[model samples]
Target: MPDTSRTQLKQILATRYAYLVRRLERITGSKEGATDALHETWLRLDKANVSTQVANADAYILGMASNVAIDQHRHERRHAHDDDVDVLLGVPDELADPERILTARRKIDSLKDVLRGLTPRRRAILLAARVDGQLNREIAERFGISLRLVESELSAAMKYCLQRMQEAGDPYTDSRSSGPRKF
Candidate 1:
């Protein structure tokens, strides 16, 4: 890519960084959880041939950003050394393979559309609890709702997520299927 186009891509990423971060945070569940993932994503996007799509620049960027985030998460889980205590406690090693990243991006994109059918609050609450590591009381406080409401909303939200994941063949149903996965 040309220098100017690379600068343009940087500008787009810097401007839209927060939006991308928040979405990834919802998925990864923590601000730090997605920082590296997103940074790696930017590096990949900058290297790709996206300069011709200036007509829908933002969409292209967001698509690339989302894909980058998913690939990072998948890599963290798939690494053979992730089970090692020291490595596990440290940052998850990043995946630099384009093909692996592309595959992860496609699968995650499919799930993203499925997740969109949920109400904003429902999505927020579930992601906050499951991904962001927030407790029910914390979620309630964050949303300015009562604890009882968080409990109930989470109950319904978990059920909905479980059903959706089941239909989508998401690993979430197979893994966390005991507590939060209960439908």
Candidate 2:
């Protein structure tokens, strides 16, 4: 009985090979992948024991092909080919150069110096607004000051840092006639 069913499926597959391939191509998006999936489907049908009859052989065959294609895609993703490794190796390193790293470190140190130079209350206000991510109203309430005072302190602190950074030749400073640093 199973042999009879397998034979019937094989006959249907052979008769509708082109139609099945077209449908599979639409599902897999690649002609070669679709063809391979169909071939795998054929091999599976040979091995499979169909105890019950399939009501719609065409749809069953297409579903089997789709499953095979999905399995192939997952297997390919899990096992990287040599070309993939070579491509990864060919990619340029994106890390900053030593000069850029040094400049960044210097900028950080300059910022720290500027922050240290501020009055303790101003420094605390700047840290609360910037580092602590507190709202202006929240900061004002916490410090027992008016919202206007909080805003004024934050603005002054920012302006002072900008002036100090410009004096220290910060590449990012707009004060330079050459414009902000490219990097």
- The most accurate candidate by lDDT is 2
* Candidate 1 lDDT by residue in tens digits, 33-104: 667766876788657764353655566666676677777768877885735867667866577578878978
- TM-scores, one per candidate: 0.40, 0.47
lDDT of each: 0.73, 0.88
Report each candidate's C-alpha RMSD, comma-separated, in the order given: 17.9, 14.1
Model 2 scores a TM of 0.47
Question: Largest TM-score belongs to which candidate?
Answer: 2
Residue clash pairs of candidate 1: 29-131, 29-132
Looking at model 2, report the run of 10 residues with the lowest lDDT sum: 174-183
